[model samples]
Target chain A: MTWTVIGTYATAICLLIGSAFVMVGTIGLVKLKDSMTRLHAPTKVGTVGVGAVLAASIIHNFTFGYGSYHEVLIMAFLFVTAPVSANFIAKVNIHERECDTPPKPTVDEHWATLKPNGIEKMPDQPAQPSNGG
Target chain B: MIDLFNLPVGDGPGATFLAWSVAISFAVVVISQILAMVRVAVGPGSGDRILALDTMVVNAIALIVLLGISQGTSIYFEASLIIAMLGFVSTVALARFILRGDIIE
Candidate 1:
């Protein structure tokens, strides 16, 4: 009985927390001004929002149903892929000129995404020796 | 209200609290989904739209997990997982298409 009470309350708390984070992240996505700045918002949904809800599901399952760890697979997948997708989106923003251009690299003339033409040659290839070795 | 789902309101006040909290979270998640849809509709750039869509996908996963909890079932887990995978793949594909004008190259 005591365990049931602990589990139920914990699950409820997790659900509420997850819902709050999801709300905040969506609000950020809608309200933020710039494209690059807006990119910063929805990541919370990918991380804490869905994460907390999945945690709630795991707790609820253990307490009230047959326990299973499959939800962890979903959680792990989300954690692993969130940053990759975010990076891709940022790259799209840069390529499309939707966001501010990043500062010039000290060594390179252009950011790789902003390079003219389609990857024609490697940047700054060392000169081959005129004399054959 | 707690009796709506007919969930097992275990022999304590916590059970009722749990049921109510789940209901509230369901409503909250739905609201967030709508907000994300709004972003998708009016976003100034394609990047914002893609980001909004990604947020919507994550929100959908949250909604599915809540449904599983409220209904006391684990079956929705697979549905949410598949959605998560599809969401990531679609987001990356869309971004890649915009970046290179080709998804496979």
Candidate 2:
């Protein structure tokens, strides 16, 4: 039927697009110079790429009479959670690396603020030498 | 009316072949994911590893949907949904731990 052909063509198109994204992601994983750039690759490609392929499957299922919505629920779930998951992973990675430069501070800023609770200044203490004895 | 849009009346009307095409596409996604995993394993930085993990989760979701199509069942959908929910939770927990060094803080 015409619907079936339409579904096939649509699925093919989705597959092509998804594959392209996956390939790009893979290349980025290999070629990106640093952690932040690497994060962008999978987030851009992996989430949306799988989404497109899953959408195509849903269409194919509906057209073939395997039931109109067998795979739709899965598609919905993926859409809901994929981005959140990516964000989480990126955050964790940023945290674990503990790069010398904290994410919040800019290059020109002082690294840390003086605390008001610190002991009132004592007469400058003489430097003490450690005795290894 | 339904047959009006059907393809030129060849194998295009069959269900099995359509399922096969979906399977093939899913296979491609899985293979690409495995390639991503290689990066995860050899990653010189934690961020690259996390990126690979995220890619793996997405590939799993795609595989579940394709399974539903191939098997003509809704059960796989439920499993996929469960995975999605859990994956989101884990990712959030991990992220919080990374940023603040404690899940609660």
User: Per-prediction TM-score of chain B?
Assistant: 0.94, 0.76
Show where candidate 1 strays beyond 4 Å. A116-133
Q: Each model's TM-score?
A: 0.90, 0.69
DockQ of 1: 0.76
Deviation (Å) of B33 in candidate 1: 0.5
Choose the strongest candidate by lDDT: 1
Model 2: TM-score, first chain: 0.64
Q: Judged by TM-score, which candidate is best?
A: 1
**Candidate 2: clashing pairs of residues:** A1-B5, A1-B6, A2-B5, A2-B6
Which regions of candidate 2 deviate over 4 angstroms?
Answer: A66-83, A93-133, B1-10, B13-20
Candidate 1 chain B, run of 10 with poorest lDDT? B1-10
